[model samples]
Target chain A: LQGTVTRKWDINKLLYANNIEPEDVIDRVYNRGGDESEEEDIEEEDFFKKKIYKEPSNEFDSYKPHFSDIEMLKNKWIFDNNNSNIDKEDSAGNSPFALISRRFILSKKMIGEDDS
Target chain B: MAKPSNIVFQTHRNFRIRLILSTLSGKPIKIEKIRSNDVNPGLRDYEVSFLRLLESITNGSIIEISYTGTTVNYKPGLIIGGQITHNCPITKPIGYFLEPILYLAPFSKKKFSIVFTGVTSNKQDITIDGIKWGLIPVLEKFGVRECELHTIKRGSPPNGGGEVHLKVNTLLSSPLTLHVTELPKISAVRGIAYCTKVSPSMVNRQIDSARSVLNKIGCEVNITSDAWRGKNSGNSPGFGLTLVAESKKGWRIFVEDIGGPGETPEDVGTRVAYQLFEELSISGAVCRSQLPLAVVFMVLGKEDIGRLIINNNQIDSHLVHLLRDIKKVFGTEVFFLPDDNVIDQNNENNSILTVKGSGFTNASKKIA
Candidate 1:
């Protein structure tokens, strides 16, 4: 886009300064019509009224949610719409230790047998 | 005060974005060894043409190219945008030049009204319709007003002559911070099947086939056919399709396809239809071509962080380099947080991209 014109930039893992997604929107003009589960759900406010509700999901996290299901789509929308935990471990790339800062790793003064 | 050092770069891999960021950020830059080892080295015709267009719109942009065109030293000046005309090289579609200019014109000191003549639709880049319908609304979200891109004439590609008039008024001192993180689902589908100097009947064939595919999606589909004759059709003979998906939240995704030699109108229709489906299936709020513009605007907006929703599968090697170049020029870094809201809770496919803006205001814009 010239890494070997240098594509090495491709292999370099992204540096998330505050670690939102070890990765990567809409205006929430929320409607109250689909609040069948609002009894068990909590409403959140953004620039507009928004909702956050959990959907049924497998624990290991290998599922690609189909967009055909309206309920599933709504859950995915709410869950992604929340940016509060963007830098958390769940939002990081390597599922487990996604938010481990590169700066922290670089700051670790390791000898590696000190064979300079 | 003394001058700041320039952002040094090598190769032409990411030629356009660097210039765009440099211009928007007003940072001096020096690029070296652009296609240095290629068969015919140095700046290509389109690259030079883009530089010329930049020079035309700005007051004091000093662009210096080495004898071999392998190197360029550009000290960007304030954008003094006004009515201007540019004849782009036929080597590239006008989309190449037009797309980046949209990133700039809003910050210009004067109202930007320009007439660009060249290829309008092609396989290589986003067609003019894509720009008019696709990117403009996205710009609106950023608070830019009075934007218009009109296709005065249609020119397909190779042996080309086309004219497009673009006007962006209401000098925006700075674009609004993008707060859109939840990409609204597409609610309607709209499209255009335009043909110039070809069998007008082909339009129907293209439209019907595209409709065949889109009808399955179950959105209110409307594909309009436009046939341009005589001078308005430009010099080349060609036809193409532009599809735009709109959401209630004003999210628009545009996809275009042009007919190649021996390629049927039906084929063009199906190609573009499938392309739209592919885009819809992907999770990004912005399409591949629109990604650079969206990301850059976020970095240049108010210092507060701007967030965008995108799919990991959408990040190509091109974007990888763009993110790196953005850091070098703007000193702004982007955050990538994964999304695990899927039925399988797959955290890797989707994520929110956050960038703390540089809060750039147009220095040349007169305080009215």
Candidate 2:
């Protein structure tokens, strides 16, 4: 009976009264719930894509630096196996001269380099 | 020899690849269910146009289409390549027709000296720049001589009007064997930016933007611009960039991009340059889209084994299907082995593909 007062329980107020930081509760309640990997991929992928995902408000602000091809290779067939849109954005045509040229040099012993 | 039965195919997918393989292997093909379920069904105008073009340069070739155009029966004939003119449809670019013909021309009775008129560049198809810089070099590996691609007029889509002359001499008795398992560093980079029916300034603008990114490769870059005016220019205004990077071994990789409505010249140039940069960073021996050509050539080479080391990233569904189709038509098996000898661990994800050539020669060519 002593603890029978049905008071409205506001976690924020309780945390405030106790000087407790409701960090975890705040994240769960207000965060958009995207997983960590998804967030990380979005951040890394936007700069590599040629097509502008969104309109630029200002010219200078939308400038994306050119990424090294090695860096671009990081987004290889791993993503393609899932049949993702990223592959579609860059894939060559199924028929004809797709011209998707990235052919690297193929040397064995570094010796037979005579094809010129 | 008995006339081989037709290879039955379903759907309109990969119509061009199948057509070429059938022609080269002398296998008749029956294609059915071409968009049979679609409300507006039947073979598209481009396919019909392409068939007509094939028939013109070939002897005794018979292509019969059903009344509804849903079914097609193709019996390929000897390629008597000499001089021909084809007015291609706007549904596909001029490169669409050229890609297949280039493969057939090497084994023709004479040599290929053809003119193609149609949409020169578009988003959905390969462009002329790609044919010259990308495809042609691969053909050169087969010892196809006196090869040249001259753009007489620049055209865009919709109201398309463009003319191009493609001359390929030296009908090979047999395609040369290819054994490029490794590549040297890129020695130089070159490109051409073209603008038609638009301000000539667009060409320079596009070239500058492309060079801005390509210059970082620390290699020599020579990018030129071509601006067409008046009658030579296509009906629609458009601009595009095509780049070719030559390896020390003389093998080349290509990059290209076209400016569409709402896209700025800078966008096309930068995108193409970045595409090339990205391509160079990958460890493949050929560009992604051109893998089929390289593989097909190897398959059609002399009976000796031809070897190629390809970056694993270049293998996609398209390459997978192309390999299957080649195996089906040519009866040649291609072998892929793990490439564990790469010096750098970062570039170790590759395979060595070896195809035993069928020793296919120009059967129709008369011997001296």
Write down the worst ten-residue block by lDDT for model 2 chain B: B341-350
Q: Stretches of candidate 1 above 4 Å error? A: A1-116, B1-3, B340-348
Q: In each prediction, how many residue pairs overlap at the backbone (N, C-alpha, C within less than 3 A)?
A: 24, 15
State the weakest 10-residue window (summed lDDT) of model 1 chain B.
B340-349
TM-score of 2: 0.76
lDDT of 2: 0.70
lDDT of 2 at B53: 88
Q: Tens digit of lDDT per residue, candidate 1, span B254-304?
A: 778789999899888877776676566564677766677788888889889
Model 1, residue B347: C-alpha shift (Å): 8.5
Tell me the deviation in Å of residue B105 in model 2.
Answer: 0.6
